[model samples]
Target: MLRDEIITVFGGSGFVGRHVVRALAKAGYRVRVATRRPHLAQDLRVMGVVGQVQLVQANLRVPASVERALEGATGVVNLVGVLNESGRQTFSRLHALGAKTIAESAAAMGIRRMVQVSAIGASATSLSRYARSKAEGEASVLAALPEATILRPSIVFGTEDSFFNRFAAMARFVPALPLFGGGKSRFQPVFAGDVGKAVLAAFERDDARGQTYELGGPGVYTYEALMRLILEAIDRKRLLLPLPWAIGKVIATVSELVGALPLMPVIITRDQLIQLQSDNVVADDAKTLADLGIHGETVEAIVPSYLERYRHHGQFHEREA
Candidate 1:
């Protein structure tokens, strides 16, 4: 809420972080986008006034680099998270340890306003390593900086999202869209723009510190229904194959192997396959986007805006934006 405040955002170059940066910049805040490679996120510089947004090369895995990134920052937002392990970027290292370093560093620098972005299914006792690591990361962050706000989002969707875009792209050429666990799992997808606003609101509210908020969209849809919606949105028809967990795991294994290539597309990891077994809707009685005073946009309104490119006639096709 305060103008001219300095806020450093980790993972500002990511799908969700870009929107968050834009929101912060529009709020008249000086934002420092810290990522592993500063050059890759150069576009973030244009999101704010001439010099309001700056980029710094910092990897969460290293404490020293994180310390340097937080110099002269009134607040910090950790949007850094990994879906799959790639060599040293494992779950424990990035999610758990990386989060701790940021929180502790912020605390050391007397930065009271810190927000950490976590997933919806994070649990210490979860069967999935990613989930467990996320739990560990949350615990680590709170332990270090008790005032830090923790945000847990369920399937964040946006113009450049991996969820809607991936499936829509596959529908372009793939004969069938694989439905994990018979596509029975349910999800409450949130818009990235809403999430960005949520981050800003959390930082402005004093009560938000030390609190955890679960963010989701207006509607909850089953995986199969969502797939059908995407098929309809793109104006394309394709087989909707219900893949068994056993078969999905095998494909996940092969995908992981192939994903190691330098330019390989991100395939479904085994942990992601496991994540599909459970529903990702907001918990009963849990706080949500409404709690932040944000009327989260529905997937119906946002998805078609960008997914039109995947259609047969691209944007030439007549459909709602």
Candidate 2:
């Protein structure tokens, strides 16, 4: 494969997208980051040489914008997704339709390579709208171009991630943390960088074409166990309350309502509660990080480096080693 090929990445400024872009740049690929806000993606220019990286304003909802972004790109990656529905970013619009638009444009424009980043629990029949829309996106992409690659990753974590960061932030101020469904739901917390590497690997390997890869870390932990891991990382001792499913739903709904206010953090949404009903881990006998030739980063090694910032001393704490 030519390293100098142009690759257009939708949502390239996102948590995982940023890492993917960095990895692609390091691998010698010129990257075009297509996002709704080119201003926000300005920092990506530094990822590559003076002009190796370009940011183009493209909204997937607008087919014309999607097509323009694909111009002069041999490879494309769709990382656009939403955890919750906001003003105009609905799951159906962003995940399903957006992916379809990109896939169709790539196919029509004769773009040979593409990849879609989706979650593990995505299903056409899923109760969670998030999961269902992701499934829809995968299906729509394949319908347009059967050779397009698809990746389904478990809960992705990093210093900038909403998963561990959200809880760590809450632990800093809240007296207690709530665990939905008794925290029994399992998750394989893959590192964000690992996910990026996997994306690049998929693009490099011909065998990965038209195949779905389920990406997960080396270890799996329950919801409660992961919470405890966060607590240990932050060196904070707080009650881990196991809230009932019904009660958790109520709280999540209230939180979304509060999000409607001027300046409220987007806490868990009702769709998230619905997603928690299923374990977010790679399925048995399925190809995973190992198949991608990736030894994913562990929670123990990576989580601490970032979570240390949330510690009492805030990066000044003495290291045991």
Best by TM-score: 2
How far residue 91's Cα lies from its native spot in candidate 2, in Å, is: 0.4
Q: What's the TM-score of each model vs. the native?
A: 0.96, 0.97
Q: Mind giving the per-residue lDDT tens digits that candidate 2 earns over 195-302?
A: 899889988999999999899999999999999999988888899999999999899989999998888987899899998988999999778989889999899999
Query: Residue 233 error for model 1, in Å?
Result: 1.2
Per-residue C-alpha lDDT of model 1 across residues 1-321, encoded as one tens digit per residue: 437679999999999999999999998899999999888888989997789999998988778999999999999999988777888888998889889899999999998889999999999999999999999999999998888888999999998888889889988888999998899999999999999999999988777878899999999999999999999989987999998999999999998889889998766989899899999989997888888889999999989889999998998987556
Error of 1 at 180 (Å): 1.7
lDDT for 290 in candidate 1 is 85
- Steric clash count of candidate 2: 0
Provide backbone clash counts, one per model.
0, 0
